[model samples]
Target: MRLRWPVALLVTLLVVVLGTLMGSRTPAEAAKKITIKDSMGRTVRVPCPPQRIVEVNGDVAELICALGDAGKIVGASSYTLQDKFFTSRLKKAQDVGKSFTPSVEKILALKPDVVFGYGKFLKPEIIAQLERAGVPVVLLDCYKIKTMAEDIRTLGVILNRQKEAAAYIAYFEKYRKLFADRVKKIPVNRRPRVYLEQYTDYTLSGPGSGGAELLDGVGARNIGAGLRVPYPKISPEWLLAQNPDVIIKACGSSITSGYGEKPDAMAKKRAEMMRRPGWSRIAAVRQGKVYMLSSEIFTGPRAIVGMAYMAKWLYPQLFKDVNPAAIHKEMLKKFHGLELKGAYVYP
Candidate 1:
């Protein structure tokens, strides 16, 4: 009670200092939590650099692994393991179930901080259950070519990997432009007529579809452009009448037996198409312009590879120097930290 003035002043300053210290937090502390808007237009509060995550979609899992956060994945869809690329990288992640029907029990047991899922495929009830259990799920739609860059960026933001996201976008756009810039110079009259066999024979990709978009990007005319549906079945008669200049059969993903293990699988598929009734009279069959295309490339971030190959097939004179296989190797090495070798597309 009889303390000196200096001592009293010192004690008051100590109290003020303690209060200020208690009120403030470091940048790291503030960065722990972040809110983001996913592709579904729903606001989600998630942990930045989430420690544990579950991936319901293989493509999303692949993208996350490519962004250098593979360690964060605690669980993944069962189909992810089927893809050689994902299987090699996501060896640590437990298979929860199919992407569209993930097991809620396994997911809850994993106690993931967040789950990356498909908005269109995953049932709404499952999403609701997860949210009710305090798990935040961010839905992403990567089906369209236009939304891929944005989807990658959104994922990057959520995971606090904006730099990686920007880098990926740059790489993706570079190849996309590599196709568009050269193809745009070709005269309209020279555009080749392309018939795309989608996931099966007779099933074709029409206008306003991912397959059609790839064909359009490479300055090729989709023979099914006039079809009423985005994806329609072309009768054998119709296909023969169209007489496309180039035909690319999409293999894998609903195709019969996934191109098989035979070394001549691609050749066999081509031969089968050529042997189809009335196909011998088709211009594509006669000129040997038919090729086998991987469905994975046309429907994923790797569509640039399909574009390159399609351009080469459609206009060999224009894309004589374009090498899609080399581009594929480069992309795998650069983004995926992988040296995957396979026949993605072939004659």
Candidate 2:
């Protein structure tokens, strides 16, 4: 005898059958997810090998490009759009706006699989907003020397470019160890006292900052290391009183010195620093030890390149064999697939 099923039961059975036939995924396909603990210490589950990405920070975007996945970038911040290297590669990407204030609607419209941002700079609200929209946001700051290796490795895993990431890390370690081995041998008293200025005059890079770490990595004693804040502004008299043995100015976008630019702006910045009132008595000025470094190299993923220059400037005899320009060119060629054509340091 045939039995008649209840309408509700029949509907449930039909729905289940249709769902299995139309929406079921294989185990391998269902498991295509990666769990990542971002720089902010938040665990995020991202789709494996994100095909479309929105990178809000230029430094982080540079890392993505270095990983050989520049083609996957679908949206970028204004900073990345303005960068010659990024513009050349990400010609088809849409600019969502500034890194600090990205347009959520614009990013959502792109249907990105993942978004990259700097934990320290991008607001938590923006990250939350993206997450609510079913988009994953990974905070990775590629600037700090201490965490750079881990950050790159994480990116490598997320992008399935483990080989490229390992190579990049090895390259960074080569120079890092070169500087570390040589710097460690020098006595503490022999290390130069350095005053590293930020983008603005009288603004200093203090403890816990990437700039301060760069100086420390090269065995230079940062005069402002004892400051309570990361970036503190001091009076001119205070700067003169420090009498730092070496003065290094970090120039940002205000001074063009990186990627298809001339060294004239850096030269002018150096000369202006040299002409500061009462700075003539400073040891750095008296001995012609004042130098200018573009923020492009000193504050981001290529900070080691800046460190190489700093090492040479502070201890010319010790780092004579270390050519920062050569290293810069090699990095550009090997990682970013670009030729070195701009001035990163000045005479």
Candidate 3:
């Protein structure tokens, strides 16, 4: 039996209304917006899975590669290209200029889903340009020991690689706890007075600095902790007075890279440290307790590796079995799928 025209018309209207409602919900369901506050405390709404990304910081980009989302990265900064480990995988990504001063034109050209940058490094105008172009940008603090893990987790969620991110976080926590547990066993009086020399002779990282955070994590004392500034240029006489029990010279822009491999160069540098006016009288020099560290090992997620080395250095007997080199190899191999060879630390 055929339905009446009025009833048929009403049925047709209901069907059309239901279809419209379903169609409207499809886009929202396909890609949901997730609200997250960046390190700068700016509220942001990003797509659940960002397919195209631009990471300005090499360390943050490294973490992205480690989380198995390197394909998602469409643009990167200068440092990422210079990184030997990351060069091959990220070679295809567009060079977005310096870590701090990326080309707004290039970034706009890529039409990335989102852009990640270091809060301290990125310029205000660049961020403003991206924001004005309707490109979502999230600034992060990649180096701080307190928030590094959380930052990784946040990236994992944004990239939809939570499982991979959790694995990395777990590895970081394990090593972090290992150092903390062993260091805690030592008494406060036993903690060594350490001077963290940053690349240059007198430049030091004190309290509130990245080096200070690592030393604190490993339960070591920063002799420069008394300094008012985070990165201060102290006088050689002041260092002589502090008489650090241990001296860790960090290799970075101010110093030549790959010098750690050259025994003669390293010896010359070490000799120079020993010959500093009144340095011979200092406890660290007198006891021959000096070490060379690489900045790469102490930045970003790799800082935990630096802490392990410090723990072993600070208390050899307790962390005798903790091999930082082996851990470094495993982390790079397992997370990054790269077999990198280099000397990051030296006696």
Quantify all predictions' global Cα lDDT against the true fold.
0.81, 0.89, 0.81
Compose the digit string of candidate 3's lDDT tens values, residues 14-45: 99987887775523234777988887888888
Q: Rank the candidates by lDDT, best first.
A: 2, 3, 1
- In candidate 1, what are the lDDT values of residues 1-347, reduced to their tens digit? 77567878999999999778766743323347788887789999888878888999776887887789998888998877666667666778888998999999999998888999987779999999999998899998665567779999989988888999899889888888888888887787778888988886798998767788888788888888888887898799988888999889888654422212332666777787789999889898888888888766776778888888888887788889989888888888999876746667765
Question: How does each model score on TM-score?
Answer: 0.83, 0.90, 0.85
The segments of candidate 1 whose C-alpha lies over 4 angstroms from its true place after superposition are 1-31, 253-263
Which residue runs does candidate 3 get wrong by more than 4 Å?
1-30, 199-201, 254-272
Ranking by TM-score: 2, 3, 1
Clashing pairs in 1: none
Worst 10 residues of 3 by lDDT: 254-263
In model 2, which regions exceed 4 Å deviation?
1-31
Model 3 deviation from native, Cα RMSD in Å: 4.9
TM-score-wise, the better of 2 and 3 is 2
Worst lDDT 10-window in candidate 1? 254-263
